[model samples]
Target: MKKSISKVLLAAVTSAVMLSSCSKTPDESRYIPKTAGVVVDLNAKQLTTKLVTNGITMDKLFEATQSKDTSNEVMKAWKDAENSGIDMQSHFFASFVFQGQPAEHKSYISLTASLKDADKFEAYLKKNIANFSLKTQNDFKYIWEEKQHAVIGWNKSAVIYISAVDPSNLEKYNPGGSSSPDYGDPSEPMIDSATAVTDSAMAIPAALTTAEDDAQIKTWVAEVDHLFHLKKDETAGSIEPFAKLLKEDADAGIFVNPEAIYNSGQFTMIPANVKKLMEGSFYTGTVNFENGKIVFNGHSYMGKELAAIYKKYGKKEIDMDMLNKYPSQNITGFISYAFDFRMIGDIVKATGMDGMVNLMMGKSGLSMDDVLNAFEGQLTYVASDFAITKKESPYFPGEFTEKPDAKWIFSLKVGNKDAFNKIMTSPMLKEVFTREGDHYTVVNPMAAATMPAMSINEKFVTLGSDSALLQEYLGGKGHIKLPDGIEGKIKGSMLGGYVDLEKVTAVIPEDKMDEDEKPVAKKAKELLKDVTFVSKADGGDVQHGEAVLTFKNKDQNSLVQLINLGTEAAKVMQARKAKEKAYEDSLFAAPVDTTVVAPQ
Candidate 1:
């Protein structure tokens, strides 16, 4: 019985986070209070409608994966909310705010749901709260219950959860608690609940009853409310960058202020270079479900120094024509990036990495700049085929090896062939490489032959794990050509790629998994079997890009299928755990040997 309850509890916790499956329409950014330091908003309604139009509903999806004992409190709550005239499809925002200034900062995560039938929702919310009382009478842990503003409990340091109600409209829910104080230390020192003892069931410490502590709770509540209520003297608008992105038709978005993060002093452990890189840039990201695909794009506004470096040496125009050299069909996936490595070297210098590089190269009479000038920067990697090899073979495990081998072909455009050759032919390099007609082939010292090869030309240098792939490309036997449709999508971007999901899934080896896990792996393959991805990145005044994952299935969207896969995996995992638990319990509860042998 205990094991059964544990299994149910595990399933309940897993399903709770996945409960954001309801649908809702878009609402303005006004629902997010200006005080929010970071916010994530989801359009459950739009997603739900999209699923329903394609023949799948949230309820149906859940029912398909239902089991006898798994907890379904979240789904039940969703049904209740929907039936009570609540806008089933409304925008829900999760915001994180720093409660106080640096050194004494207390952070809180709050949620706001856009309300459609406010009166009906409020009545339903109040009734639900009436049946529940505070578990701890004196230990006040502030939790936002339903439409109620925020109930100030005894312990002010507890994590709070808030609902979607206007701050101005919350007067009715405010009990006659002490008015928010004007000024004083608002930090509530974290209480040690594990060790502290109390007479009450909640174990409220005696220190909490002091007048100073009680007043601190009032001050904390006032501070939380103040975050939503903008000050008259303030001029810098609340989350302007993020709000603008929301207004621009983004289904969801997130933002973080560098100044706020730096001042928080919570990130003192991060490296200086990384911190500079983050603090010197502002980022805003958006998600959109359009054109039968889900697209996520992030735009970065680089600080002055970084932008200048990028403009000087990093920027390049991408030419899709280069993709024509690749095999037109039978290709699983490919990635291409247009970059100038020399410019990258310059950026490294600006970032203060030059000193470290110089120290490493000091004895060798080489500098970072000299190293960066050696070869071309642009690169393309193509995965043409995959095969299973055996263990007894000379080149690979003949028929004895169990794992599959991945075959890849890479082409890197050399910036300077002369410099590249000098390094390849250097004394240190001569030990591993032997000159072959126009390039070098890495040789096995004992075998003297079996090795991967690299080719160099005036325009490009190519390497292949399998020499046959390199020979094929050089011989023009199996050049890959991008489909016209995919080509068009990548034309104007500095970097881009396309992956054939069907081709990738077709190669999944079910033999790799245990007999029981094979079925779940097979299900995953089918779920994402027909998806394709097109991605691109562009550099300019602001660097931004998005990868669009398009699904070929007409019956359901990619997200719905993804959720189904997760649900299926969860069910499989739960069953496995239950089986293990039962086995464990049986060992302990097994009938003991009642026959007492002669005492030895």
Candidate 2:
């Protein structure tokens, strides 16, 4: 009975050990602070798999980039990293933290990654880097690179790198304070020299020296250590949306705190009212690499004020009728958007900047309301029939050169006829445009020669590169037929865009291209198919969007295609450089024309 009990206990212990070994480790993102203004997470394992599947090994990439020198520091570091015991299969995180008062603002850049063997990494660093030393404090070991103002710290599980600027040094350079510089005008109050000097003196700090740098490095080291010991609540993982984005199995993910970034000292020149607009807003996005296309999915959460405004106006779908009226069937590209113009007025008023905006426009006898109310908020810009034609050079008579030409139409739906008339008749525009029936024309000869034909009415205001095309559009003589896929995306979207890269490339004069540019252009044409983007309000305060870049080969991954293109481009560039070098060498080797004619 005792022998049987011992065998069962040993078996249970073996099973527990196996279970522990098989469990997955946590990502490095848990170490990033919630206050980080921006965070970027890279799925190293996913990226590596994609590259490998695409036949893009690091050795091949280095070869393509002409990094043949093994002695290169970057190469050496990369080789060392391979053996450093860092977990290359886990997610890596980079974060930017913006904190502190405007007068003494601090910015911290942090990079975090999981570790397999901390001691091996330390040894690798010491072997590859000069003047490297490690210090121990509590639970973590750290090293500071004084010149870079960066501190690298690590424990048994993960490594963190923190770098920051000394705010004192920033204060020394920006002695005029965070406020905008006073550009004195007769209408505005002038700041006397004595007052200016006092303000500048107060804003400026003592000069920065080696001692201050040392202190800053020490602070960074503590910051690194603190990051390693952060509580779960203090981490970015606590942000619900950001955490969800990380779990979406994307190739990469990004999170941005607009309020924190805009409030940073770097943007001190921005008006307080403008900065308030970004408060409480955050943005998150995910990037995925799939077969045939690369996609970016994004979401924006607006502030309370902005959300209220958005909710009030709601979303306006793009007008298919207006887009269909475009005069050409061979359309190359287009950008269509539907939004309520009144939202701009509301936002300006909400930010309490309407008074200043009206004050600036008062000189022209126009108000912000007059400008915002004139548009119905649906706009479409279409370019078609792109071609490269030989035209007589304006500067050199009788000389012809290739010039790109395309027919384009820019149309905007009219909201209120009276408001539109008010803007057209405003003091600033009255002298520039002349009314002919329901349409307007440029009064200046130079402007008329360059500007497209414009027609305005209660329904729409349209500008066309060709007058006939403009008349046809107004008369409803043409119809635009978009691809079913593109039409479906744009039909109900608040914002949508499409570009036919293949068509654009077909119009280029390949004969005119330089020797070095031809191969790259050819490769690009072979790889690129088309690009499309669409965005819409998800609901309430959130906006969701996607942009896709599709490639020609549907079987291969888009990333692989891109890598192949890059490698081909690199080869072309190297050949060009070699040829140029040969020419240069031949020039040097050739004997000088010493037996030249006495007179030219």
Candidate 3:
């Protein structure tokens, strides 16, 4: 299975990965062993099961929905969102549409726990999860039943919730859901329907009833909210390890059966292609119970096969109805305020999502958004362990047959939180995910034998401030530097390199002294002329990827010109789509602030 995982990764990165011709050693071959991973079909039944676990039964779910506080808060949040400027009700579109029926998603849960108890839970979670490390621990989340409320924490502000719909239901509304996927399911304990319980120890929830409690739930709700939000006084920086694990579990990475491809005959040529037509893709794990079994279904996918297949049939140009047939991988993923299909999805469909985002980001005609959306369709295979293969050189006959000191098994994905947790425990990932607290860490271990994962967070600093890149290996974070005494800033970032060069421009800083150019700007009577600039190894102007700011400084002003030596420009606005998606996903984290500031 591990070999097969390596093979699939090799296939996924064939074009992007760099290969070597090193000789294989017997010790190295013996080192590679079967990895410890859990893979299950996150089928429809499984998904539905996890959602309504004994802790949250169907009746309890609806009842919670009916609770006065829940209904009131949801209504208030809904109305505030509706009445506010952004209209998720319409002016929004998700990159990935889970259920095509245009369903509205909203979660209302509250939790409170002591710092000591929270730490215990976090430690407990780290102990349970294999490969758990302190460096990556922050990436995990924990959900605990506290007397105050049901606590869920990760990093700083973690909040886990349950949401999703059936694939069949998605096909029912969106014509573009033909490509719907089943990510993976929970194992061992039945994927039973979990009823939500407010007691500690996750006690079984009470029976359903047509009765109402006289105890002021509203007062309690306010206090709980205060504890988590306003009264955050001391709890603000506290770390809840269990909350962390719960949050990590909420991520799409864990739900993927990271071993699917190896199990597929086409990729490994070893494992018999079991007759399973549908394999779950990517999803947030569910902890529901049904018929005494727990299951899962709602999630996202790499959509490699589905997208390849869908595009082969020209599904991109097809309508929503065709989307129903689309692997219909969820598209346009972001926190939506409300459900308004026509204004959000339809309008964007007409104008092109990528193009619109580019325009929103002050650039036009940039297809980066499109490229990213498409990229998601691919990388799916890379998520598995056996997708990458090593020891295939003719120099060694008994390559993989032997082994070495310790086998190198790359993680499909590991955020700094989990990396931190792992760091606290596992020495392997700790050496890698070492960034420190407050801001957090990131560790993208390459699952491929030939390819290394993009080094995650080789630097750490305040969220809004600049941080120096530490590792020479990491691709490094986005950089924007301003020229000395110039009215323009030089900024650029590494893309998978899909940036649209034409749109990459240096914006003239208005704060600088541009008195000379001021006249040129005011008397701009002539048509815009294309001025070619020359590239400088040290201090020359840019021509090819370079350009000179030709403001008429007839007398040659301080040469305070704007130069776009920066990398290409694409829709960098949605670059935080994944992080932001995690923010919206109460499972991983939550909006600590009232509003999330756009990622620079």
Best lDDT among the predictions, by candidate number:
2
lDDT per model, in order?
A: 0.52, 0.71, 0.24
Query: Which candidate achieves the best TM-score against the true structure?
Result: 2
Model 3 stretches astray by more than 4 angstroms: 1-255, 258-600
TM-score of each: 0.69, 0.83, 0.16
Error of 3 at 28 (Å): 32
Candidates, ranked, lDDT? 2, 1, 3
Ranking by TM-score: 2, 1, 3
lDDT of 2 at 356: 92
What TM-score does structure 3 among the candidates reach?
0.16
Question: For model 1, what is the C-alpha lDDT against the true structure?
Answer: 0.52
The sequence of per-residue lDDT tens digits that candidate 3 reaches over residues 142-190 is 3322222222343332222112333224463242345432211211111
Question: How many clashing residue pairs appear in each of the predictions shown?
Answer: 32, 0, 147
For model 3, what is the error of residue 4's alpha carbon versus the real structure, in angstroms, after optimal superposition?
44
Predicted structure 2, TM vs. truth: 0.83
Better-scoring candidate (TM-score), 1 or 3: 1
